[model samples]
Target: MTHSRKILVTGADGFIGSHLTEALVRQGHDVKAFVLYNSFNTWGWLDQCAADIRGHFEVFSGDIRDPYGVRKAMEDCDRVLHLAALIAIPYSYHSPDTYVDTNIKGTLNVLQAARDLGVSKLVHTSTSEVYGTARYVPIDEKHPLQGQSPYSASKIGADQMALSFYRSFETPVSIIRPFNTYGPRQSARAIIPTVITQIASGKESIQLGSLHPTRDFNYIEDTVRGFIAMLESSNSIGEEINIGSNYEINIGDTVSMIAELMNRSVNIVSSDDRKRPEKSEVERLWADHSKAKNLLGWEPLYSGTEGLRKGLEKTIEWFTKPENLSRYKADLYNI
Candidate 1:
């Protein structure tokens, strides 16, 4: 099932995308990283990738919203992993139009190029946020997608657009729905990094939003492995698979565990600015990854509460480093 491929990973500049790009390069695949265009000529996290993979892969700077740029970056690439999108929920509140253009139309650009170029496979990234509040425990692919926030709604549009190509043009598209991936190089906007950065900054009291909501967190390594597994499996064509640790923990308990791991006695303070609107908040998410295991022969190595602790230990260790901790503004709330 393993073979050399010319792969293009859009949004390769971001957290998960950078890890995935490095993983692909180390696996001996020809990698083209399509990072967002910026005036500063920055490549997001890829600008700071490990020295071993510093020049191992190609970087294509462009905007996913541009069809011409997308097509150009995807040229001659056999596989495409679409990860670029407007992901911040709070920013989406007042700027929903940007989400539509980036998440929905941006995805359309990838689908169009994949269809026109006749790529071998296309893996579209989907978030657990699409499932919303989880109508039932251990949500699976069949669970109805509810776009509680503009970010989630846009992703739902993107997912349907990808699926539409498969049904209409028979594009080899596979959707990978990853639940709350966390680890090193993560943005402080996310809860895990938020807590780690705050505590690492010598804060006795942590500012958070809702502590009652629960999430199924997967380590970055596991999430990257899931993407590779999805790419390798022929059965993934036209299928949507969930990549998760299958372990649920409330935000409060997760913070407590992180504090214990860091050996810090910290107080959690609820911040209104960080909390989502009453209707927009995704209260719970618990993944049933049996489909991924049955289809792609993939499952999270970090698969339970014990696994979560191990993952957090590593995350804390990384974030506590002086060089890494200095990059984040722990005092500021990321909206």
Candidate 2:
């Protein structure tokens, strides 16, 4: 947790990963970012980061599914922040095998390498989806995990794999489960970005799926700070902590709020194609952050309205740009 120690971040090119990586650099940590390798030589969201922040990173491009590549990336790093995985639920329904490979097997690769290399700590990223629909409000760590979809199922496998490393091999590992983080650089596959991009693109009707499902949304900065707090706390080892705002809002209301924030008027159209299978959709999520506060002294700074307003403002600003808007196909549903 010392700034002097080197940290390796997998999925550094992603939305949360990029923000976390930039924050680490700004705090003067020795950062090595493991971005997914692609022939385009693109660094995804990392490329959108400020030049100064990107300059501080020791970027390594490789696939997390490859054990050899993962080992090479972890070599000499004091800690690992593993966030690489396939996260889209709709896509998982069609290509469950790839989800197994990337989410489960990729996590196995990180665990094996961390165990072998003697990393001080491995902060494995987890999702609220692993909890599925909350049987009770303000779900705690003790909540039962329901694999409602292949994506959540794969994450369950990954979370268990990380815990197994901690129990079996005594690997220094902690699970940071964040709920519905939204912010700039998020992909169109996510609802916030999907709505923002569609509205920014001048769409008159917003196409969406089931709007009744409630979610506990956390801002990017709060979620990133949760990761750091986990890394800094010795008590966090062998623990699974939830990082969320401990608030819930249904999808329809959220869309309305976004529209109000953007000062845009549009019709919300329920698209049959956007709805998830009845059994697979997670109906509600409300986090219990007491464990996180008790263990790591971590608490979210942004209220539900404040976080959504700021995050959406930033995201809308980004998407309003011709170049950024061009990257998204607002007319087409993304997964």
Candidate 3:
């Protein structure tokens, strides 16, 4: 928040990118938002953000897979936060080539552009999925990465490409690996939104997949702050830092918690269509955020119940709005 530099955010139209872009504008930074090009001239989540924040952003339409477009977007920017990628795990199973093209090759475009443009810092977004199932309690940076799904495999490829640029060309890069982030504007393909949408749409019985897997869910606001804090810390360059609440809860318990927060109870049914293939599912993920704290002075500000309440409130508010809930087909399985 100190120096107001030109920050380029790829995937500014998506959930996390849109929030990060808005956060940057609120912090008084000049932002250039790179959104995917389309014939409709759609801005995605950027369309829903405040006018003042949108006014501060310079919107450009282009594809991240195009190196030329990526470089053009980075021009005159002091830093870059790469968030564009194919994020749906189930979709990746069908079109893995696209995931590799976007996540891995698209990341290559960003890193190459940053190195060529001499950007001050590049904050690359990573996911906890890269660790697969947790091998030990509080998974840390040193934990072995297991690519259990095509989505995770592509992310692993992307992370390595960014790190290689750091080690080889000395491009200033920090991998901001955030655990599961949920909040308003999230798509129904994700768990929290799926649950909230079902309840909002008046479903008597909630259909879910495997409910045993546990995840460390960070509220979107804290995740955004973690990105800024990581970039602000000079010591974070060339380091991979986790941004997550240390606490985690199982999916079944999370459903109960959400129901409790909403003051509604419903029977939960396991749906075969919602479940992941046995080999592709990640059983557990818990974050060891000690590195982030010791190095970048970062820690999650929201605990589970607090974060869940905030997320569920916003999600319920959004879904209850006729226009917003219409985007999701709650009667059918998203995967």
lDDT of each: 0.94, 0.92, 0.89
TM-score of 2: 0.97
lDDT for 136 in candidate 3 is 98
Model 1 C-alpha lDDT per residue in residues 1-335, reported as the tens digit of each score? 23246899999999999999999999888999999999999999998999989999999999999999999998879999999988889999999999999999999999999899889999999999999999998999999999999999999999999999999999999999999999999988899999999999999999999999999999999999999999989999999999988899999999999999988899999989899999999999999999999999998998798899999999999999999999999999987
Q: Report the number of clashing residue pairs per model.
A: 0, 0, 0
Better of 1 and 2 by TM-score: 1
- The residue-level lDDT of candidate 2 at 276 comes to 97
Pairs clashing in candidate 1? none
lDDT of 3 by residue, 155-265 (tens): 999999999999999999999999999887888889988888898788989999999999999889889999999878889999998888888899999888778777889
Q: Candidate 3: global Cα-lDDT?
A: 0.89
Task: State each model's C-alpha RMSD to the native.
Answer: 2.0, 1.9, 2.3
Model 1 segments more than 4 A misplaced: 1-4
Alpha carbon lDDT of residue 39, candidate 2?
Answer: 98
lDDT of 1 at 282: 96
lDDT at residue 249 of model 2 (Cα atoms) = 91
